[model samples]
Target: MILVGAVVVLLCWLLGFWLLWHIPAPGEFRRRAGRAPAALAVPESIPLSVSVVIPARNEERNLPCLLQSLAEQTRKPDEVIVVDDHSEDATAAVAARLGARVVRAPDLPSGWMGKPWACWVGANAATGSLLVFLDADTTLSPEGLENLVAEYRVQGGMLSVQPYHVTLRAYEQVAAGLNITLMMGMNVFTPLGDRLAPSGAFGPCVVCSRADYFATGGHKAVRSAILEDSFLGRVFA
Candidate 1:
């Protein structure tokens, strides 16, 4: 029994040591990113029109907060459109009341999911040079839209950002598990980072030029995908 216990302890110690040595600390990722390329840099004076497109289904309660945040933005959207995905709730009414143009998402096609279809419809309707696709539940900070546009002006490509989630109640704290799972799924902190092609993108918030969106085929390219964000990211890559 003593010999068997000794062997188990040795194995566990080795496994722990292996993981400790290989997993990356999140901050280390910034160090790994080298200088930006000259080709990606754009002049500061360039002007681009921005549109905020939100796809919603049964989000009447949450939609107002987002629109309110949008209204409070230091850098306003040229236009804000909400795509109502056949919600039983009063989503369209609430959106129009809050000063957002409401558009009805057409019926789900044979090959597309609700979100991607709504997004596709919204994109086609948008008149801006830049498109910001944001989830209905998300609320931006005052400088949020400005910062996004500024960053896009510098980098000039599809940009994805993970929103910091806040839990208002103890019960909501259980959502930390999903947060942990997402960090682990990123593969950035693991040995698999080099071997696997990264498809990890924050689907809840994304910004890109309308031209790049169309060039990559946009959401329509990944219409039938179960995880359309991953597929769309892969397509853009």
Candidate 2:
């Protein structure tokens, strides 16, 4: 009994430490790629037309903050599409109130899960050169779009970033930290930096060129996947 308890404690400690260690890499990438700033010189003469797509399901509590943040972007998205994924609450109403074009999600197709299906629905309705898949819980800085556009322009491929999560619970923080660390330990950015085929990055902040999105078959290819974002990343690679 003593040995089993000791082993369990040790495993928990190691896991906690590992997660905390990786928390900074996403922040580092955000800073290095220019998305962390509040102000940037976004060219008005050549503004990139971006479609920001948000997948929402009973997200009334989180939608307001995200919508306000989007409204404040330094380089505004040309259009915003919010897919209401069978929400029982005011997800559709709130989104429409915030000036986003709200699309009602149809029946969950046979293979696709909730979020990715919503993303696909929104993507089909989008009309922009750039497609940004943003989560309902994500809050972006004013210069967020500028940095994402810059990253896409420089790489000439897809761009994804790890967003800073606001966690009220200790376990949530630990999860965020650990997830970040795993990505860093895997050296996710180095290959992306050198233009090697982009691998699975986070889905929360995925941005891809519209042409590339279509070329890669968009979310249709990964409709049945539980890890649709990662699957899309592999396909992009």
The total of clashing pairs for model 2 equals: 2
At residue 221, candidate 1 shows an lDDT of: 95
- lDDT per residue (tens digit) for residues 105-208 in model 2: 99998988888889989988999978999999999999988778876654556777778777898778778666665465434444344334445768888998
Task: List where candidate 2 sits over 4 angstroms from the true fold.
Answer: 1-47, 184-197
Best by lDDT: 1
Give the whole-model CA lDDT for all candidates, comma-separated.
0.81, 0.79
Which candidate leads in TM-score? 1
- Native RMSD of candidate 2 (Å): 5.6
Per-residue CA lDDT of model 1 for 1-237, tens digit only, reads: 999999999997775454333543323332344424333344555678999999999999999999999999999999999999999999999999999999999899998988899999999999998999999999999999998887666556677667778889999988876765555565444555656555566788889989999998999998988777767777776
